[model samples]
Target: MSVPTPRSPAAAPAPTSAAHRTLWRWHFYAGLFVMPFLIVLAITGTIYCFQPQIEPLLYPGLLRVTPQGEPLSPQTLLERARAAAPAGAVATTYTMRNDPRASAEFIFRLPSGNSESLYLDPYSGAVLGSLSVEDRFMKQVRLLHRALLVGKPGELLMELAGCWTLVMIATGLAMWWPRLRESGVRAFAMRPASGRRGRWKEIHLMLGASLAIGALAFVLSGLPWTAFWGKQFKAITTAANLGRPGDAGAGHTHAPVREGNHAAHGDHRRHGGTMESLPLSEVPWATGLTAVPVGTSASAGHAPIGLDRVVAIAGSRGAGAGCQVALPGTPDAVYSVSCFPSDPKAERTLHIDPHSGNIVRDIRYDDYGPVAKAVSYGTSLHMGRYFGLANQIACAAISLGLMALAITGFVMWIKRKPANALGAPSRPSSPPPMRAWIAGLAVLGAIFPLMGVTMLLVWLIDRLVDRAAGVPSRPVRQ
Candidate 1:
């Protein structure tokens, strides 16, 4: 007797709900606004992820150097780079070479409030080239990622887009949840039987679901770097003592150090708990940490010792290889060396007193508090540093996948559009379940201030338009 194989069962039909209709309506609008900005972010972000492999190719003159003899003195490198600058230019900070064959960068400021960088041969102190802040391509890409190439105003717009993207994801998942349950294993099943539009829908949905985890990772990783709300998020995490750099569990003595320069010690009351005003997400994990003193107070002590002594201190502390010492700008500024970008766990941040070259603060990844540890690791993963090229490729793939989804979504919208009408989901019957909806999204609004403002604007306009037409909204047919 031949045994018969069991056949798979068909999926049940998904039931519709009032909440789903309301969510779908909002999700459509959110997607309409967010899709374009998301495209820009994905493109720029993909480019940035491959920057490690690309920068050398783009600006070899400013990045690479011939390794000859030992590098020149740190002081000499600074002087030569500044001297090569235009008259009245002043050098602020210079980066020590992490790679022996890499060019040194001396950051300078001009009278017009613009910043420039001078690249020099660390061995001979010869100027390689100078690049103005705005003219650099990578710098512009960075601005594009944070803002829409529009500076502060652009930043607000981008933040709004990011928040709306989150909304879109939330609503998309809501619509997908019931469908998944009803469709069973076939929830992930794709069929191209209905021609182009149907194929696009299945492809878009599946790709989006596949990319969900990575997409969320990128979004959350970026939040801590946002200008307004992101800064606040950092401050909150730090204030809660959750971001301190040190292993609290191991009972390490984390001596509190002075944070930033104050007019006097009394000024500490005003800025005591605040993180230092370091560039946003510029340094790997330097914000909200205590700043070490220069081994002498500004009023009573001698000038800080030269950079050579600090380099020696860093070398003694096992930060010699693949490390860079950032020059101190202010008289009382401490010298800091960053090492071990390859592995977040092996990372080290050593701050030295420029006055006596004393090691003031030495922090390692294991030394971070819980939140700090998460943020640190998340940042590395987000930047594609954790897994090298593979990480970059994965991020790039996610970006490309998002682009595909956006294109397919727009195409579907076009194919379904009524001649002159907006291609939105059918409006809800009666008033929306907005009371609960607002309460649920209140947290999102708080975290993203601009999103909160947008919600208010949307609610007002929605009400005004509904009342003027004086008609109950009808649900759309699938």
Candidate 2:
């Protein structure tokens, strides 16, 4: 029996093509660089998806009230809120009809050279008390998520992470693409097999593929808001005739009118009374002016409508649920009544002159231009509000998927051995195929300006580390 024992089969040698090795290296290194950020994004994105539901619960008293009596006027609420605060503090009141509750908030400059927020209830006009940004859970989470508790550097890191995520998706797909004829496309998809490695691979592939499109959409839409991409996008948009035009009167070539000096003009207009003019800045907060106020157009003579009246008008105009009324700042200014109807697609913005209560302007989702509509839709998608429950579910699933991808990727990296050889030292492989190397470099350079720069830095660091570690380098031959 001892004599009959057969020799164990040797393990198959790993593939060693320069292209394959380079692809794996980039994928591995990029995964290492981006894992921490991906985790932060996943956690934050998951929490943010439920903000609409969570915010109401967290501030229930400020958001809702019993429908026992009529609500207070916006002006009265604002005054009450200010009385609750310091002497000079000004409060902004938000009167919400759908929830039957009102809220007032004031931003104050503290003695410590920082801004603080004080929340108040408009229904009872009681100060809920001041809240520090640090103490605010959502604010802290948002800051950490968007910027890693650091400022611009943190934001840049996040943008880089997002860009790397796209890279990971692309490289991952490329690596997973089966070259062999026998392998099914489903194999490249998700294949749940028995072992730990098999399970991890399945998760990595499945989650990566499922959320790739979503992640790409999120990244592309957000790129226009990034520093470099924003400038580039603005330039491109302007070149493509998509830029916002300057003010209508800009660059008008009208001849300049030589009006008399201030004193002369004042004397000339004194007799007309109707020709009197007031400073634009004083119009909103002005206290005294006996005669019919100067610059009183046809729309300015009627009585001003309060927030309550605005809400009533909006309801009468068939606004859907969750209507909000914003009071006019000046007599001639228009009250903005905005509503998000039961129909998730319906969003209406109405501007009504508070004086005459006449509708000055109306803009619905249907009225938006192509770019405006796209922007609105993109915002809705980003906030997970475009399709309500379905969107929420999709976002949640995407978050979970992202988390899974990160975990599995980390595990895969851990399973791989350090770059070394068995028994004897192995020679360095030749440079990668010229075409493949150029293509990868070009693609990466096009997508991330930082990549080429980072690669050069990495090369320098690698050289230093190799020298410091006393690892032998390939000899140069002349």
Per-candidate TM-score against the hidden true structure: 0.82, 0.68
Query: Where does candidate 1 have its weakest 10-residue lDDT segment?
Result: 266-275
Query: For residues 44-120, what per-residue lDDT tens digits would candidate 1 score against the true structure?
Result: 98898888778899989998999998888877777687679988876665564568878988777787877788899
Question: Which of the numbered candidates is closest to the native, going by highest TM-score?
Answer: 1
| Candidate 2: tens digits of C-alpha lDDT, residues 429-450 | 5655658656776777675676
Candidate lDDT values, in order: 0.69, 0.54
Which pairs, if any, clash in model 2? none
TM-score of model 2 relative to the true fold? 0.68
